[model samples]
Structure formats: structure tokens, C-alpha cells
Target: MSLRVLALLVLLSIQNLFAQQLSPEASIRVLTIGPGYNLNDAFGHSAFHIQDHSQNIDMVFNYGVYDFDTPNFYTKFAQGKLHYLIGVNYFDDFMLMYKRQNRTVQSQELDLDTGQKQALFDYLLENYKPENRRYLYDFFYNNCATKIRDVLQTAVGEPIVFHEPEAFQPQTFRTLIQDNLKTNSWGSMGIDLALGSVIDQTATAEEHMFLPEYIHTFFSSATLGNSNKKLVKQDKTLYTKQAINSNKSSFFTSPIFVLGVIGLFIVIITYFDFIKGKRSRWLDFTISVLTGVIGLLLLLLWFATDHTATAQNYNLLWAFPLNIILGIQLLKKQPKPWVIKFLKFLFIMLALMAFHWSVGIQVFAPVLIPLLLALVIRYMYLVYYLKNEKL
Candidate 1:
């Protein structure tokens, strides 16, 4: 065990001995930390803050902590089997960490009575135990933000009736995520590619708590089941993010710009190949390997992984895994007769992909437009060349 774990155990024992009952001045609040620049921190964070002057306890219970040293960490993360822990930090230390990150921090005091406050605090303490701290983390349902809402409901032993905030607007899960990411960013494109149509469905108001800001907004207007009293008794902004201009990347480095350039080059190469009545075997091989590898990875994400959001992905239609075989055939002096039929099938798949995009069956990355168009043209040219080739 690490020193941190030992320290937490010692702290827990001391708290149990002397702070069984919190003083009337003890307060329990929810802290909402604003989003940071990185993809991992883009969704912001939520934690529970418990403070008591009489007991000399001031701690933040955060559910977002994960160990990078865990065995097979990256593999487990990719398979959606990674565990997150309930981390206990000194309240001042927690604030200082976020302050250094230049993220905004807001707190909302709960309107719970002394008994309720103690119950919630006790529950957090019990949950903080080593065995109880680790949990299977889910992005939309059981992440740090959603844990705050669920834990509050569990501790209060009552339903939380969350009302829509005044500025609330209906949005899908994907859109909620996109709100925190730049449209042309690699992070946004990756999310659009990996997650499927499930996130495209409109999220219910209660479901919006998956995001930290939404947790604050909904909790501000929420009430306990037994009473109409507001769940949040007070609110305060502990830190405001500074207005320093971020170093934005140039458009030249953007996914759309880079992909567009590659796509244009492919189209130009295909045009030359068509005029010369010749096929660029190397180009076909490269494109096929790239799309085939991507397709296989997507297929694995859908079936081999525990990720719920990667299911029913339609990107496979454009990135056919069988293209790898076609690429091999294209290298032969006399390709198989079925290669022509396979190219036609790939063309049809592209058309179906376009249909799916048009009807909102799935939302693919917008940056793929140029690449997809180039692919269609290349496939069509290949079909023509194969059909006209002599035995």
C-alpha cells in the first residue's frame, strides 16, 4: 500500500473515533469544477465537500480518481474494464489543484438537516474504505458527475425531483460532449468515430447529470421528495477561470484540413491513373490497409469490448474490412474475376453509408467528407479499370 492509502486509513480511524456526530456548524456541499483543455478533463468534474470546524475536518470526496499504475491500465481502459476510486483530498489541497489548472470552481451548499448531513458524511466515509472505493466507471451513467446525484439520492433515502434549469435546452449525449470540444479537433473527431448512434439519441433531463455543469444546474432547481425545499441552500463561486488567451492550433493542423489535403491528392492520383489507363497498385494497397485496419478496430470495439457506446457503428460501411483482400488482388498481374464484383459491392457500401448519414442513422466525423468522396471516386475508377482489363 502507498503512503497515501495508509494516511487515509489513519484519518478514517480518527474520524470514526471523534467525529461520529458532526457539529451543527458542519456543512456538506457539492463542488463543481469547470472543464480543462485536455480531452480527459474536457467534461469537468464533481465532488462532495464536507467541512466541520468543531471536528477540524475539511475534506473533498472525489470519485474521479484512477490509478495509472494499475496492471494493464491502458488495455483495461480500452476494454472499458478500468476501475475508478473514491479519492479523499484535503479541501484546500483540492481547491489549490484546480486553481493551478485555472479551472473555475463552484460550490452549492445542500439544505440537509444536521441528521441528513451526518448520514451523507458517514456514507461517504464508509464508501471511502479501501474495499468500497473502487467502482466500475461508466461514462454516461456512473461517472464522477452522475455519482454525485446518485450518492445524494442514496444518502438522503429519498427521490430527488430535479427540475429543468431556466437555461436548459434538450440535447443528445453526443451533442453534450461536443459542447465541451472543438468541432475540428482530433478529440472531437475521435469521439464521433468511436461512439455510435446510442449517444445520438436525445438525453432525458435527468440523464443530463452525466456532465458536471448539468449537475450544478439541475441540483440548483431540485427538491427532496418529502419537501419542496430547495436542495441547494446556497451557492458560491470559489474560483473564476482567468481570461488568458489559449494557444489555439492553426487550421493547417486540423483534421479536416489534413484529411482534405490527403483526399485531394488521392483524387488527383486517381485522375492521372484513369487518363493513363493504368492503376496505381501501391495507392490502392495503402488505402485498403488503412481503411481495413480501421474497420477491424471498429468491429472489435463493437463486439470485443464492454463499451456500450461503440455498438451499431455504421462507419464500417465505408471502411470495409474485406478491402484488404481486394488490395492484395489488385497487385496481381491478372486479378480474380470476383475483384470487379467486390469493387462494385464497396461502391454500394459507400452509397449506403451516405444514405445512413442523410437519414440521421449515424453521425460520422464531418472531417471524413473529403476522404469519403475520394474513396467513392477511387472505387468507381477501380471498377471501371477491372471490368475493361483483358485476360
Candidate 2:
């Protein structure tokens, strides 16, 4: 064997030896970091903390780590093909970073025996190795918080009975997400637009751990398989967040106000066309083309992207793709019979959207209320205009 290969083997052996020798004073903890000001940090973070006073070892194992230097980073991320890796850093450094951000930091020390603690620590080290670290990230099924929950359960080699928190109730994935965001914020509107009806289904109780705060709550009450003993031994708050000024927002820039204005403008134009006994071809073409484009994009997201939550989108009911084909019919002075039928279909689709919302099949963004009303009124006028014209 080459000298370099032999040295590498020796170094790995030494590292394994150290991992197996975790002292009785060592503790394995779950660290939950509170939310921050950005969309990415809105859900917060979860990590494993390993501390051994006797051996002078204190480090955090984080599964949410991703490198921006990765090739084709933006493209891969958009396609949901980005790989996230487990990273290790000193505990003090991790704490300091969150402190600087003014985010609350909390810790829950697991009630693991010395053998279990050593086993978990060793397992984490093995997972941290280059070959095993990187994993495909799934937003709902496999993420930072879920990883911590799964790893801790695996380390215990027991069925963890995660009891539902007292305040827990069933909620859809979109509702859970919107709960963390401002109702009228750009982020919320973007999420509603980009994601489809798949996220409208109710999330199961155990599935709620996808969020860091829920992980903390569930783990606090979880127990070992069929045992009365609780999983967490102690809970500690490492840092309290300081209040920051929150009066930095305005209503005019919000989606509700912006879409509302557009809706009002559409209504005014339609009323003018009614009085003149004429249809605005430009406005009709624009709305048709816009909805057609949005429909095409939603279809692409549903079929092409790896995003699991974008399937079965009902938004296409209102943003019909057939509008592209029907839009050309609007330019002609004499409308085709098929065009009138298509207008009726568009009005029906709008009604179906309202029905869907009413029956809780899917909940759309509230910002769309005014826009939907305008669409219905415009379609009704178009149908009347075409039918009343001389054949």
C-alpha cells in the first residue's frame, strides 16, 4: 500500500476511537432557533448539539447547510434538484451567529444514557463524512427539522411516541405556511401563485414537524417506545431576542391594494364599453393573453418541476389555457359561434372557482377576490355582447 493511503487509514481509526469514548458528562441536545426576518428563515432552524465537558468537545451538527458556490446553484434550486449537506461547527460560533441576528435560541437536552449518547455522537460523525453527508432536500418530507427528528429516533433504536401538542389541530400545508407570513406580503402572494392545489390538502399531525417550532413542541412531549419516561431531560433558553422596530411597512405596496386597483380599473372599462355598446378588444386580448400565460406556467410547474406541492392545481380553472386559442376570436368584428360558447365556458370556470373556494376544495389567495369578481362581470358582458349582435 502507498504511504499516503496507510496514513489516511490511521487517521480515520483515531477519529473513530475518539468518537467511541464520549464521557459520562457528555450530553446530546436539540437546538431550536427562532424565526428571522427573511423568507428562508421564516420557518426557523433545527440542529443537534453535542457537548462533553470532560473531553472539551462542543459542536453543532446542522443538516440545513447548503453552499452557494455550487455550480448552477440557482437553476438546480429552482428545479428542486439542489443537494443539502450536514455541516459541523463549534457550538459557540453557532450561538454567536444567531445572537447577532437577534433570533431566540433554545435547547433541549435529551435524556439519553451514556451508551446512547456515544452511539448518537458516533452516528452523527459517520453521517458527517463526505460520502454520506449530502442528501436530496424535500421541503415537506425531508428537511432540517425532520432530519433531527428522524436521527434522534434512529439513535434511540426505539419507537418514539410523538404525542400531539395540546393546541394542535389539523391544517392544510398552505395554511401552515401562510401562518408564518404576512397575509398581504409579496412572499405570501408569490407562494400562492407558484404552488398549486396539492398544498391545499390537510397535513397530518406527525407531518407538522416539518417546521422547527413544531419539532420542539412534539419532541418535548415524546416518550420512549411504550415507556413512561419523557424524551427531554432539560430545556434551556440560550438567548432572548431583542425587539426591533416593526413600523417599516406600508399598505399601498401590498398585493391586496395593488390587485384591488387593477380590478377597479377593469370594472370601469367594462362599464364604459357597456354604455358605448362596444367591446374593448385590447383589454379582452390582454386579459386573455395574461391568463393564458399564467395557465401555461402553472401547467409547466405541475408537470416539469420536481416540486411535490404543485400538482393538481385548481387555479387553472380561472386562468384557462384555452384563452390563448380563443383570444384571436376577439379581434374579428363578427364573433364566431364557438367564441360565444368559449365566453360562456370562461364564466362557468369562474363560477367553479367560487364553488371550489366555498366547499373548501382549495383555498385561493384573498388578494384574488376583487380580480375574480371583475373577471365574472367582464365575461358576462362579453357573452351578452356576442349573442345580441346581428348574425
Q: lDDT per prediction?
A: 0.89, 0.86
| Predicted candidate 1 versus true structure: per-residue lDDT over 1-391, tens digit per residue | 5767866765765466334789899999999999998999999999999898898778889897987878999999999999999888778878988999999999999999888898898889888776788999899999999999999999987788998888778998889999999989999999998888888889999999999999999999999886898999999999999998889999999999999999999999999998999999889889987898888888899999999999988889988777788778887767889988888898899899888889888878899999999999999998888778853
Error of 1 at 275 (Å): 1.8
What lDDT score goes with residue 283 in model 1? 92
Can you write out model 2's per-residue Cα lDDT over 1-391, one digit (the tens) per residue?
Answer: 5746754754454365454589898999999999988889988999999998778677788897886777998888877888899877668878988999999999999998888888788888888777888888988888999999998888877788999888779889998899999888888887887788778889998888899988999999998888768999899999999998867668998899998998999999999999999999988888898899889888877888788888888889988887887777786677678988898888889889889889988788889888888898899999898888854
Off by over 4 Å in 1: 1-19
- Candidate 1 total steric clashes: 0
- Cα miss at 386, model 1 (Å)? 1.1
Please provide TM-scores, in order, for all candidate models, with all chains considered together. 0.95, 0.91
Which residue pairs of candidate 1 clash?
A: none
Candidate 1, which ten residues in sequence have the lowest lDDT sum?
Answer: 10-19
